[model samples]
Target: MATATTHGARDHARAQEGNRADAMPVVPASAWPDPPCAAGHLVWAETVAGGGSTHRVLARGTELRLTDLTGDACAHLLLFAADRPWERLNTADTVKVQWNAYLGEHRLLLSGQGRVLASVTADTSGRHDALCGTSTLVRNSRRYGDGSPQSGSPAGRELFKLAAAKNGLSARDLPPSLSFFQGVTVREDGTLEFTGSVGPGGSVTLRAEQDVTVLLANVPHPLDPRTAYVSGPLEVLAWRAAPTAPGDPLWEATPEGRRAFLNTAGFLASRGIA
Candidate 1:
């Protein structure tokens, strides 16, 4: 395999051809912070589709930002009471309270019982999909009758089972989810349709209404082939406090990654998800 030096040499050669004035500085991997300390709180993680997945949080009052990182990424976001994991995010109530079909600056996340989760304080490239549901083997099987191991993991189904056992809730008690950074188009019938995302590198930031445990995960879609994944590694990052004013750190992590950990923690917390 070509070492970082080899890649650097190739980049230098390209820069020389472009001219010194046109060349851009290349930040080495070593120079960049190797992820952040905020990741320590992560309790659960899994390899997902797409490449370069990671997650992290900021300190109290510190702003945590989530970027799609790549274009066309659909992220499922959930939040639970930090003190009680059972009290999960309620997107339905959020939509009702905001009186909007889509989530954005106008909407705030609500818990299953109709409590505020977080407000959508910022949305870059305002194209997020609300109807696109969370990924699961149940949905996958309906899409593809039967396929190879590449067709989403049957193991992924364990998420629900685990949730049921941990929270003491039946499968029926799971909360509905919201998909972020997706495209929702109103059709001629005035119905919302799930299209592609707005574009790559879009993001959103939320200010917690209460102490909340956010959950995010990146698993292969039931329809995608596992062999095609470039880097299916799972990354989980957490922050003890909110981020500083300058902005949050850049992470290869997807919004889904954060939600996964949040879900587990919240479900187990005092709220009692079951």
Candidate 2:
């Protein structure tokens, strides 16, 4: 007879313990109120602990939302085209092409080829950074004494390395990352000022303009002046949604953005990707 506390993988319900698969999406309605889409539409959901990392391949039109559950969760993000590994997120072009330093809704995350990889579809947390990038092993070790993924103070780059490898990518594929929730400001002297994250429950959402592999690390912002390695929980939710269309308002927001969208559409069409 099986005990109430224990059960086999193929147990026939004799045990009363709570069990679930490793890859099960949480109940959408129970997870969060007012989700962008209905429960059935939700495709992915997970809560990454402080100083943790996550990776996922999102299909075109998927909407991913990252929430600062404790207000200090810094989401370091990297993106790569699912089909074409060479086409990766280019933070420099993302900033240079847009000619905007700050990020908000409707900002298209572009690739080096000037095509849209993802776009900021919704944002309640206005603070974001594309300049300082993520914490490195050297920086973390100097500041917190340990920089490995198992350490209390893990380097964002190292974490991303491990996540990237899971997707057949290497350190070279890990391009400069983008950080959300933690931000910076430019001083008059052209130096950077760390405007650390504040306020809880702030969330930012992005829509996949093309199939993309997203890698992330929820580590402390590199510029975070705090000596202690303070990390927080980050909630991730993704759902199926409609991809951008030619008539979308964002398509007409700017000439540069319009061009990027066109380029992305052309590529998708050429590949017969829907």
lDDT of each: 0.47, 0.88
lDDT of 1 at 170: 53
lDDT of 2 at 84: 91
Which regions of candidate 2 deviate over 4 angstroms?
1-35
Best by TM-score: 2
TM-score of 2: 0.89
- State each model's C-alpha RMSD to the native: 12.2, 3.9
How does candidate 1 score on lDDT? 0.47
Best by lDDT: 2
**lDDT (Cα, 0-100) at 222 in candidate 1:** 28
